[model samples]
Target: MTFSLLARCPETGRFGMVISSSSPAVAARCAHARAGVGVAASQNITDPALGPALLDALARGRSAPEAMAEVTAIAPHIQYRQLLCVDAAGRTAHWSGERILGTWGVAEGDGAVAGGNLLAHDGVPAAMVAGFAAARGDLGDRLVAALRAGRDAGGEAGPVHSAGLLMVDAASWPVASLRCDWLDQGCPIEAVARAWDVYAPQMAAYVQRAMDPREAPSYGVPGDE
Candidate 1:
């Protein structure tokens, strides 16, 4: 019922994800990431705890794959979980349990990785990998390209209702955290893309301001307009 891709660009050191699902608002439940921390996506009976767990483990100096492997190895119901990760250093990892139902798999290469379960076909993850490899841009753009490829390859087994994307830089703030919980009407994936357009610049401004206080405008001034 869901498919997701998480990645980090080596040259830019940017991290992001593109996820879609027949389930409504898959974004709120599946996507979890923090600036200067790491990226995580857990779906198909999502374990929200995994978000913080993965990050904490990474913060403890574990590599992305090691953290993910440690976390997944002991999950009470490991067979049902599908998760992916890319730490701040650009390491990548993913898992699709063998006991999972219907078209479950994951592919990792270079600076990117994608995972899915209950997909429309087996080609989705591969298409996503190819898209990421072919994309020539920042991490966020490469993530979008991979998502588009998955969708073009044929998304989930049924209709999509919601989608989301998340990305964070090494700094304390984000460049974008675009999420659309309900998109049963319009194309959810495209809606997410549009939201990214609307929010990217603003988030960038916020990140920039946080990075350099001089770039931020002073609110209370004698001649403030």
Candidate 2:
């Protein structure tokens, strides 16, 4: 059971993803991207190897659908796999294997794609895409908003054990790699959303400080000389 989203913000050009499933470290195995290439989410039946190579193909100017087709073609028995891909240029493509039961995925908006398997209904995917399209602001905000929408639309098939948020930019370090493992009760999507809210400002400041050391405000927090 899972409901996840991947997107790029129109305002910031920043790319990110939100994933929650019974799976462990859903972020690392299921999500992949290159700063100047594209972002992809392969789940339900993930193939950890495909993420990197697909992004490499995109970096070389492969369109979203082309790269996805090529990847799946390499392994025609991609049943149980639900994949979504969005290129650096904002193009999108998605595929849900026929044998992937309860899987519903969507690729929509300016630069966003939402997908899931073992979900409550097909509406989940469409809802995710619509939610992202309706979202405003930076990448963080859009990602959180998309997750919220997915939950409201009946996320997963039952309960949620964990949730993760990932963002990568063009640099040595990733833009964000934050997540919540094994949250309490039915849905952890909301809790993960709150985490991002608390973390964004601080991280943004930290990033600002790194970008311009002079802007690191010298707060008078006692002995903070």
Maximum-lDDT candidate: 1
Model 1 Cα lDDT, one tens digit per residue, 10-36 = 666667788988888887888877776
Per-model TM-score on C-alpha atoms: 0.88, 0.88
Q: What is the lDDT of candidate 2?
A: 0.76
Which regions of candidate 1 are displaced past 4 Å? 210-214, 217-225
What is the Å distance of residue 180 in model 2 from its true position?
Answer: 1.2
Local distance difference test values of all predictions, in order = 0.79, 0.76
Query: Hey, what RMSD does candidate 1 come out at?
Result: 3.0
The candidate 2 region of ten consecutive residues with least summed lDDT is: 101-110
Per-prediction backbone clash count: 0, 1
What's the distance in Å from true for residue 66, model 1?
Answer: 1.4
